[model samples]
Target: MTQPPPPPNQPPGPPPGGFGAPQDPPPGGFGAPTPPPQQPPAQPPYGYPQQPQQPQYGYPQQEQPQQYGGYPAQPQQEQPPQYGYPNQPQQPVQPPYGYPTQPQYPQVPHQPVPGAPGGGRKLSAQLQIVIAAVVAVALLIGGGLWYANSGGGDEEPNAKGSSGAATGGGEDGGAGGLGGGGKEKVPADTKAKLAFQLPVPTVPDVTDVSGSWITDKAYVKTGVNSVVGYDLDKGSALWTLPLTGQVCGASRHMTADFKVPILFEATKRVAPRYFQPCTEVGLLDLTTGKLVWQTSITGGTAGDKKVSFSEVTLHGQTVAAGGLDGGAAFDLANGNPRWKPQANAGDCEDLGYGGGEGGLVAVRKCGSYDDPTVTVQNLDPLTGRPVSQYKMPPGVDFAAVVSTKPLVVAADVNDAADDGSGVSDFFSIDEKTGKLKAKITADSKRYAPRCRSTRVEGCTQVLVGNGRLYLPTEEHDGSTGEYGDETNEIVAFDLANGRMVPEKTDAGDRYTLIPLRMDGGNLIAYKWPPYDKGGQVVSIDGGTMKSTLLMENPSDKTTRTAETSFSSIGAEFRYGGGRLFIADTLISKTKASTSLYDKKYLAVAFSTAG
Candidate 1:
């Protein structure tokens, strides 16, 4: 079936003044009247990829640009093959991947510099301004996207019994699945003993176990329609606020911090699909379990029929949310409408978060008749005005943004004919100008509808931190379906000039080190211990790639391969407030088959004090 054409009078140009420029307010004051729904080009169902389509936005194709001196500079090195490159021939008589390289930098005796930390002179006003200016321009020009649509990519499961790394977690009913009445003390030899454990209604295993440093509290949105706050030190419930409707979305998306507000969706519609229910979003204070504010959402709110919210973030001082129909942002202090985007008079769907500094970035489908393109708009997070607009690469599908500061965009270049080279690539774009700077390509086969049946986990994964990009590769022969003696390693790339940071063969030698999240001074990584049974929490020095084992999880390792070989990388553990909450489970098994419950999750508290 042909896609209906866009409505008449909808020119493919910016509204009056460009983004951030003052313009006569539209009829509603905050936005133009929501344009009538236009027919968007046919799209792959929410979870699938499609063959090359007509360029929407009719954006002209441009060649990827070389890195400029303005960007951070790093030693130039050969780009490594993406993790899990497909059709890789068996190695013969060659150095193995991730071999160590001779030290490139001269090691000099440590010498204290003037105006350094503790007793070094502070930067001059001019130098500070210059540094700030560089950051502002980088934020505005934005880097390319990072981490392609993770939603569409299935997380490959670890060996049977190893549920997943102890990073991401979800709510589960208070059932002590361990043997005995579950009063067994955690092994004393464990590097970090359990500090506390609290139970709540079961949530999906993928839900994020979010914690707040400001309150020293861990939060879990239970399935029983409540957000429970627990004292991180004592594991006692400080407060429990009854929530409206189902908890807004997947637990993993719940973000909380002292600086940023927490946004969640509640639907009054018990059966949401048939009729548009009363969908509401609430911003809550992270320190106190109080409702900062609440408001009803328009449309299903950026997500498809089943899911309501695609993105909810606190950018600068604004809270932005996107839905299937469109997106809106409001001032953080008072929930006044900052701005809401007007959908083009064509069939367009809202893509979730893009990159911008002190602004919210959004993408919308706006394909021309023959070319498919997406309009990338950077909105003034404060006023909802378009700061700038650019187009995604032609022929590339939707770009899912992972970072906004050193903007990284992730997109998949499909192999229309299945020639076996479709790649899920990561790109950095100039936020101000929306130009592609760097591209990191990975194997798309790792993102098949079923990732692990034929491939390893983290093949389609990419992480950014400390001015470097982290890529995960299979450490063992994935064909064996066992990781008892094998391990994985993270390959780092300097983003400034897109050069490989030679891997340290000695670091993380016993396990696969997957950079999971960045918190405070540490790049929290999961040490997937051999045998897919136990796991370790390692703090990786972002600049040096040094590893420090923080704690070892005592989660039981069962040997049961459940229905699907797909699991989230962080489903077994959660980190917050310098603490690691490790849940004991049969790591090699699926959540449904695991013997662990949310009540049995244990916390290992590290010093929050410097």
Candidate 2:
């Protein structure tokens, strides 16, 4: 489950009436006859032979047509319409069931979930105590008769949080709860930030998004100073921060424990013009969008930072950032570094990994584009240091590498000075030390790496599950020696060891990666959905890539979310002008030519509380 956005000073409640999950029965949302879960077949109650059971006196089970499944139909007894409900459009009501289409009724908060028992049950994951009353098929038969007032409905009624219905996400950039129209509720203050940067955050500017999560947020490049944030809940911002140095990342505002949100922001900066291109990071409060802390990041410069930045993710008090300059871990409070022994060896172009806490691989590069060697460096999350210093063997000047999680693969070229025909290698770097763990050689020139998850630990066999590592690269896409676009072949490496995993083959093409949502055995990839020129996510496992529907256009169906902890929850991300994660989104969008100094920001909201 995605961590809930860090709790703010709980805003007031929202408008009473609004569209939410239907209060009526979940009548096969898409019309699939949901077979009653199989438990055990029906059985006799008393253990003795057959005998007619006595029906109750006042509240006997109504022998309505719905009470019997195989019995013959009786003569038509025209009865008055029940409860003023429609009779003309009478649905084929089953012996003991409700209508075909659900009723458009007001949601009574205490409705129970189907399949559960006991005068209505409640299962709040946040509460960590699920009240499950196992109802067997046999029991249900008797239960059907005994339940004139017991049709299970175990949901919290009015003014209750939709905590149970919440979902996991697959991308970055904290998301805003969109209105029905699919349009964002950006405020006037946000608009101004988009145009330019103010020293202090009058409003927040969000960007570097994965799905709606911010892989990275940049405050306008302040010569030495900077500002940035990881606003998880009230989603994306049109404006982005442009720090004049290497850009690391922060996470969304949510509590820790990976449940609720916890706000956090931290950055280390290297002043511009200090080291050819300095590596500077910014920290911002998500709620009000204000500056928190900043310091210089090394190994990568501003240009490197721009190229390396990824989304900001939250997991409890830990903020995991992967992109530009590999990935790093940080403390949500006070901007103190939590990760250690960071890349002091080469320019960390980007960072990512699969199936583990913090990060698994760091996309390390040395020299320049023309003579660059891009390799995946495995980093220890607990200490923020390289797992090992194994570098990809020399003579292999590579371009870029991408990861989903656990799996760290790269795209490389034999010789940068050579034409596009140069040999290309796509291989997995064992933990660290760049030893080829597993690899495949392919022919092509435009390549990129796409992992399955940005996490790396405790899942199936290897953190990187059963899948293919796709790299679409071009050769002339030069290792330019200078800053230039290089190209290489696009190849797909099967993640399965074959002996242990399934038989599979993947085609290579220009590919982009989106680790949207992969919880509960479901891995969803929203390929090139938004930031990618008309990207989409498809189910690469069960479905074929030939169909555009799978990876074509992504609906608002995503599930990636930030990791959280209590320590993280207590910290603030963006703010309304109070304390980020505590303040409100500015009302600048409500008026014209708005200035932070001119008027009070509008507190108009799409907040979880609001």
Candidate 3:
């Protein structure tokens, strides 16, 4: 797991400038701000050999210019103009897959100091102007560089779960199932039309509004302090279940009957106690838009203190939650305590759990806080007892359960993976024997799966099914000759031996593909839109790895902008019954400078039936 870097030391006082107010400049003269220290060159992803630099396709190469002082200053010949912005320099450099290219520095002529051996000579006026212009260009390019932050479980008697499925209209209650079971409805026409959009609710500050689900009649989502079920086609409120406090966490898995688990505060936020602990757990019935039951437990050191949870998940009849304080479980149908926090001999506590139709798995931590030993266990859903346990390799302080049925775990062993994706290698274990089967090394530079370091079931864009693991390759240069046009593909690895599968699915030119979930034996995926196009949803045959488009959204400016606003990396996506839904997990207060006529949405839906 990657830990945030420690904060830089600060003077013992308020900021040099009071909050939101300007302050005096430093004592030293100020011209251009000091250049940041040069960072060490990035290394190749862990366990992979570094390849020699080579000229990449789609980019033109130019002769290298000699340094100023090393060779006598000679007349420079004019070079052919490069592509892209006017006067932009083009160097033939290849960035690591999925990573932004390092900024190229322009060589400048060295100036002689006043008392130096070369003696001082004033630069020509034209030369000074040229230098200033070069500096300005560099500054502009540096300022434009921005970075993106990229940030699941089991099982039981094979609970008939659906993968990315939602109920369609009609008396049969629509097709497709939720989480892992059932067949997805295939529409006659693949082209999709706009159905409706739900506007974002106004909030006083940045608020966590995570969690969403799709039912036979409604698209359910969490709001500021309530859960609202919206008409699937009309986008109007079907029903709203108000809560006393904000939702803190929700289970990704929905039961066969459409019930899900969630965590929330006991009371609404107010005054100095503006933030409340996420101590209450509840079961929500999406079909009825009601809280089936709500309850909390007393744990921690004193035994009679409320336990706060960071996440909750459901499996079979049990709904389990875990946090720093420990873990607790309850009957999913009714709010009855199944088990509470209990530390083992080594003071190990259940950090969290990953639950789905595949089964229930837990991540346990033991030993001293500074030197923790993490273990992954397959547990009996009803008994809260380990069926089989796999102790993580030494030096692995954290682990995430990606799948429980086949038993796959991901961890950044020895913290060698520098990327914040929280994974370096995957361990395939024998669920019955708790023995290691294969350790698959996923090079962070080449693979695109992301998992939150702190959340035991937070892995995304990665899937396990049919005895294989599917992952997206890091984005790379596309076939098109146009610069900045990138694409990626999905590849599979055999879970038995950890060998790469020959068959793969490509995302086509300018589009990046990511695995959404498994629909029976098929893999559902989303194709991220290019700048001028709308997004797409496709189903890849599990055996052939061939994709069939299910829905392609509108490419008009208005629709394209709205569709692209929800990033493929950060937003939640669901597609089934010829419909696709995209939603946000967080919403922030509108800025004062924003126009009133501009629209913001919590979710947008599209369908082929429209």
Could you tell me the C-alpha RMSD of candidate 3 in Å?
A: 20.9
Worst 10 residues of 2 by lDDT: 165-174
TM-score between candidate 3 and the true structure: 0.70
Ranking by lDDT: 3, 1, 2
Those runs of model 2 whose alpha carbons end farther than 4 Å from true positions after fitting are: 1-279, 284-292, 297-330, 338-358, 363-376, 397-401, 416-423, 430-435, 445-467, 471-492, 496-537, 542-610
lDDT of predicted model 2: 0.28
Worst 10 residues of 1 by lDDT: 166-175
What's the lDDT for residue 569 in model 3? Answer: 76
User: Which is the leading candidate under TM-score?
Assistant: 3
Candidate 2 lDDT at 36 equals 31
How well is each residue in 1-610 modelled by candidate 1, as lDDT tens digits? Answer: 0111111222344323321102222322232123213322232221112222221121112212222112211211111111111110111222343432221111122344576877655666566566655643442222211111111112321211122111111011011111122111223243543455433334433333333222445544333355566666666777776766544432123334633334344533333242233245566655677777776543322333323454456666666655554555666676765554443434454445543242466655554436556555555455443344445545555556656656565555443314232345555544565534445444442222111111111122355555555665545433344545455555554443333444332224446665566653246666655544455666665444556656565444431111012133423445543455443211221234244322133223322212
Q: Name the lDDT of candidate 1.
A: 0.40
Q: What are the runs in model 3 whose C-alpha is more than 4 Å off?
A: 1-182, 271-273, 343-345, 592-599
lDDT of 3 at 423: 88
How far residue 206's Cα lies from its native spot in candidate 3, in Å, is: 2.5
Q: Estimate each model's TM-score.
A: 0.57, 0.34, 0.70
